[model samples]
Target: MLKELDPLLHSQLRLGVMSLLMGAESAEFTFLKEKTNATAGNLSVQLDKLSEAGYITIEKTFRGKKPLTRCRITRKGIKAFEEYVQALKGYIK
Candidate 1:
C-alpha cells in the first residue's frame, strides 16, 4: 500500500510554501504570493492553516508604513517535511 500523504503539505500551494521556507531563514507574504502566484486572500488562509498546525510561525509587524508578514518554518515543520518525502518514496516501484 502507498503511504499516506500529509494532507496539509499535499496541497500545491502549501507544499510550495514549505519548500521555499526550507531554503530560507524566513519568507515574506508578498514573496510567497509572487512565487506561488496565489492571491493574497488564499495565501493568507493557507498560512493560517499552517500556523494552526504549529508547523510554521507567522510574525506580523510594520515595516515603516507597510505591514509586514513573515513566515518561518519550525522544527516540527522540518520533521514533517522529511517524513513526507520519505513516504513519497514508497510510490516509486
Candidate 2:
C-alpha cells in the first residue's frame, strides 16, 4: 500500500511555501506572494493554516513604518516535509 501524503502540505501553494522556506532562513510575505503568484488573501489564509498546524511561524512587525510579515518553518515543519517527500516517493516506485 502507498503511504498517505500530508493533506496540508499537499496544496500546491502550501507546498511551494514550504519548499522555499526549507532553503532560506526566512521569507517575507511579499517574496512568497511573488514566488507563488498568490493573492494576498489566499497567501494569508494558507499561512494561517500552516501556523495553526505548528508547521511554521508567522512574525508580524513594522519595517520602518510599513507592516511586514515574515515566515519561517519550524523543526516540526522540516520533519513533516521530509516525511511527506518520502511518502510521495513511495507512489513512484
Candidate 3:
C-alpha cells in the first residue's frame, strides 16, 4: 500500500521533516524539533531512518564546543515527496 503512496515519504514525522527541509537550504535540529513538535530522541530516530534510507542527509558539527545537527533533503527525497502528494491527490476526488 505504501508503494502506491511514496514509500520513502509516508511517515508523519519523516514527511514533516522532509517538507521543512525542502523549503530551506538546510535546517538545524532544534528548528526541526520545534516545527515537528517532536522530542529530541524521537527526531533523532526519525532522522536516522531517513538518512539510512538515503532520503536525507544529516550533518553533525560543533559550534563553540557544542554539537550541532543539521539536515537537508536529498533529490530522491524531493521526488518521493512529489510522488506522495500526487498519490494522495488521486484519492482526493
Candidate 4:
C-alpha cells in the first residue's frame, strides 16, 4: 500500500509555497503572490491554513510604513515536506 500524502501539502498552492520556502530563509507575501500568480485572497487563505497547521510561521510587521507579511517554514514543516516526498517516491517506484 502506498503511504498517504499530506493533505495540506497536497494542495497545489500549498505545495508551491513549500517548494519555494524550502530554498529560502523566508519569503514575502508579495513575492509568493507573484511567483504563484495567485490572487491575494486565495494566497492569504492558504497561508492561514499552513500557519494553523504549524507548518509555517506568519509574521506581520511594518516596513518603513508599509505592512509586511513574511512566511517561514518551521523545522516541523521541513520534516513533513521530506516525509511527503518519500511517500510520493513510494508511489513512483
Candidate 4 on 32-75: residue-level lDDT in tens? 99999999999999999999999999999999999999999999
Clashing pairs in 3: none
Worst 10 residues of 4 by lDDT: 47-56
Q: Each prediction's TM-score against the native?
A: 0.96, 0.98, 0.91, 0.97
TM-score of 1: 0.96
Q: What TM-score does prediction 4 earn?
A: 0.97
RMSD score of candidate 2 (Å): 0.5
What are the clashing pairs of model 2? none
44: Cα error in model 3, Å: 0.4
Question: lDDT score, residue 3, model 2?
Answer: 87
- Candidate 4: C-alpha RMSD to true structure equals 0.6
How many clashes (backbone atoms < 3 Å, residues ≥3 apart in a chain or on different chains) does model 4 have? 0
> CA RMSD for every model?
0.8, 0.5, 2.0, 0.6
Which model, 1 or 3, shows the larger lDDT? 1
Per-residue lDDT value at 31 in model 3: 100
Please give, for residues 1-93, the per-residue lDDT of candidate 1 as tens digits.
888999999999999999999999999999999999999999999999999999999999999999999999999999999989988899765
lDDT (C-alpha) at residue 80 in model 4: 96
lDDT of 2 by residue, 1-93 (tens): 998999999999999999999999999999999999999999999999999999999999999999999999999999999999999999888
